[model samples]
Target: MTNTTKTILGLIIAILVVWGIYSILQKSSEPMANEPIKIGFIGPLTGDMATYGETEKNTIEIALEEINQSGELKRKLEVIYEDGKCSGKDAVTAAQKLINIDKVHIILGGLCSTETLGVAPLVESNKVILFSSLSSNPSISQAGDYIFRNSPSDSEFGRADAEFIVSQGIKRVAIITENTDYSQGVREIMKNIFQEKNIDIVADEIFNSGTKDFRTYLTKIKSVNPEAIYINPGGSAAVAGLIPKQIGELGIKNVKIFGNFLLGDKEALSVGGQAMEGIIFSDSKDLTQLSGSLIEKYKSKFEKDPAHDALVAARYDSVYIIKDAIKSCGNDDSDCIKNYLYDMPEYSGMIGSYKFDLNGDLLSEEFVIHKKIVDGVPQVIE
Candidate 1:
């Protein structure tokens, strides 16, 4: 063997040893990937809004597969799901179990406004970050510093719906919604917006959350002869699915029905049949602008079309955002995750660009898409 060859081999060995030590040190600095990263989930798993809950869970499950495959966090993800039932009291209990028993630092859930509000104080005080995909209450802006939602708030929805209504020359309307925070909060905002625009609200029917029959409220609104009827029935198909059929049965004609985003549901179609026709539903712009394989993939896996397509996108994007934050922070430290999110630039997600405003609300814009049921399907009109 020549001396020149031996010297070259020794140099190569020294470089390899140094690089290996650096690699080990880098890995040690990251959070342990062996143990699965646990993130708590709180949403209605069984209720009228249970369908929305299914979409949320399904999207996250799909995202977990992709996230784990990408190996971004170097850890497998494990979620502890607690049913919030889309109500405040139940949400509080779910939060207790998630924070106390599950001991999770990051929470993704509580799709209903009441659900998120119920858990916000508990999680915020404990420094746990609560990121909701669909809770759209405007009051959530001040709910807590740690609270954030990817979907545009009700304030945005209110503005869009109000503008769309007024544009249609609707000088008078009636609002019928449940007493739950989700329905009430959005209704309250739209009511105020309508008043500001000098639009008269002929009747406002607010009822308890569990009322399955709304024929009485519809009857009252019909008598008022308002140009339009706006209803937000909260998160159960029990109430929402009944509106269109009953409204048609009441012989209320010549009055357009404008509803919150929940009215875009497939159950509303299946339940109402031809009766649901011309029932206008307000939706987000991102839903229309979206272009991707998300829907196709969802259809292939779930064996049916998503009841709430926009919601599926929101929940799917949230998982990616959470995974990105976890990878960057190397740990599920609430403070770290919060800081990472606050500092995050606009994330081009499945639905649209996501950038948090100063108040932790999503800065994305929302516009009303006036869609109506046609031949048992919600179709956007010209």
Candidate 2:
């Protein structure tokens, strides 16, 4: 080989060596750009309950964005969402995938109480912390230690509703609930409370969770001629549509309607309209007052105002609580975070003051009674 060619070949080899070392150093010294603390969410992304799921997903996204912007945590927060379809089987499958495939240490969802209950055992056995934002069925908390809920249980809401009913002197009442754990639980609690208050239940009926035709049930309720009707339909959009339409068509003007928090939604307002004019409900917090700047931010991002979906506020607060717990625990260890959550005294959230009890349920004293306005907005009725 010529001397010049030999020199060029040697220089090329040296350059390649230098580049290889540089690449190694770059890869070693710099952390992966995509590294994130993963949290799993399981909800009904594609069913009658999809509205709730979408609200939750949006709230979490907003919370993460704010947290990341603030740079409050050492690790960037990332959420992985799975569609539970509000089904127990789907919830179990989603939970397993989140645990085994995604390797998520913490899960923040399963909107439906049935879904939450279905996944509770698996999550508990795996020692994974599952924080439910909206599943209000009491059995969820009874599932295990690893299962935690930030929202008030159906019992709480039912008691509040019953109190409202008693205050209004509603003696003769009717109940129509969807056939699901949440609706049934609320109905049972409210029934007990009403009985205790000496209120007479004139009509009691159950409808399928996603049923669109509640005419038969409404007709039955009308036939009973109860002074008030308590509709606990498990937040199903179809029921939301049917209830108001049927009630309006049935021309039940004087009858008062009591609803669960699940009925507090845009779709319900749009469909229920004049029929929902005087309907009263017990809710965790007044969304309009509870959500301040967060509501504005949500509106800007989603092009719509946040409605009565408690899951939105709950999910947002859950993220902040997780952040606070992480900060308090001083690490990302699951046990440490769990301990911190249980030990938390009082964390002011959008909803109200949040402090976890021994059972990891948030204790708060700010629930409100709201009555639907003629314009479809809910106004706090003292």
Candidate 3:
């Protein structure tokens, strides 16, 4: 071959090699369409609130299976669960591992208020999206822009409870609160509203968490003989269940028994049995409308009914909400997902339609009163 021809050929080969290298670099920079997107889950898997975590985890399993089967996203979704044990310290640790080690940009977790409150700062600092379904502490409304919860805050619960109390012509009321972030939040809100509405707070009592024997507090509350008592317990379901039993055993009759959302806990109701009967509390609107099949599926798979169907439905919806956010805005883009959720349209799901406000709280939440009846079943009285 001629020298000029050889030089021309060499130039062409060099250009092709460089172009191939550039093309390869471009492809590497872009995300793989089939790569699974990883998300983290934090919950109290082994502590007093373990039922919440177990039920939530099971719900997530069902949701993930459905999502994967539907092929909704370009990539498959994956989750790494870390147990928070219903405490702030453990929740922080779980968040760190999921954030720093797993490198997940979104976390659905910390079912208990303490768990969510504990890791709010960590996730916020890292700009990771934290979504919760069970936490209801009012403080969580201001936790951070990245923090979001579908459950109505305790502020709403307190209002509904207080209103129901007033509507029943209960003038004097007593409050027994567990010393925890969740319970304290409810306590303060109820106290303020009761005073505002001219309802007398006859006996205000405080108890430490995990206090199985609440006869002392119940006796103190009985001495005041308030027409109604608000029992607010934290992660310890036993505290919730036994408090009412103790009250009943103390012969505190002809008095109304009021409680927070925790009163719906299956463990509490089961433990409290007949004593828990007729006790009233406020909760989200009944979700049993569409939960029949889901509950059957849950029972078939786990061989047991979910502890709280409303909460289970919320957790299931949370997975889809996250999926929608990630699909709308590319994966791993926490800011985009956060903004998408903030402006998300009315999402009608198992828990009914709702939207998020600027504070990452539900714009409108429907709270209704429920009464504990036979076999620990919660019947919506209103």
The whole-model C-alpha lDDT of candidate 1 against the native structure comes to 0.82
Q: Which scores better on lDDT, 2 or 3?
A: 3
Give TM-scores for every candidate, taking all chains together and pairing residue i with residue i: 0.86, 0.86, 0.89
Candidate 2, residue 125: lDDT: 89
- Candidate 1, residues 31-146, lDDT tens digits: the string is 55487888999999997778888888888888888888887776788888889988899999999988876678889988888899889889989999999989888888898888
TM-score of 3: 0.89
Candidate that would win on lDDT: 3
Cα lDDT of model 3 by residue, 1-382, tens digit: 9999999999999999999989976765666778888899999889667787999999999999999999988899999999999889999999999998678899998798888999999999999999999899999999999999988888888778888888899999999998988888988988888889999999898888767888888888889889998888876777778988888898889988888877877778878888888888777878747877787888899998887888888999899999999889867699999999999999988788898988898776564555655557777784
Positional deviation of residue 46's Cα in model 1 after best superposition, in angstroms = 2.0
Clashes of each: 1, 0, 0
Compute the lDDT of residue 80 as modeled in candidate 2. 95
Residue 166 in model 2: lDDT? 85
Tens digit of lDDT per residue, candidate 2, span 65-160?
999999887778889999999899999999999998777878988888888999989988888888988888977657888878888887788888
For candidate 1, the per-residue lDDT at 113 reads: 88
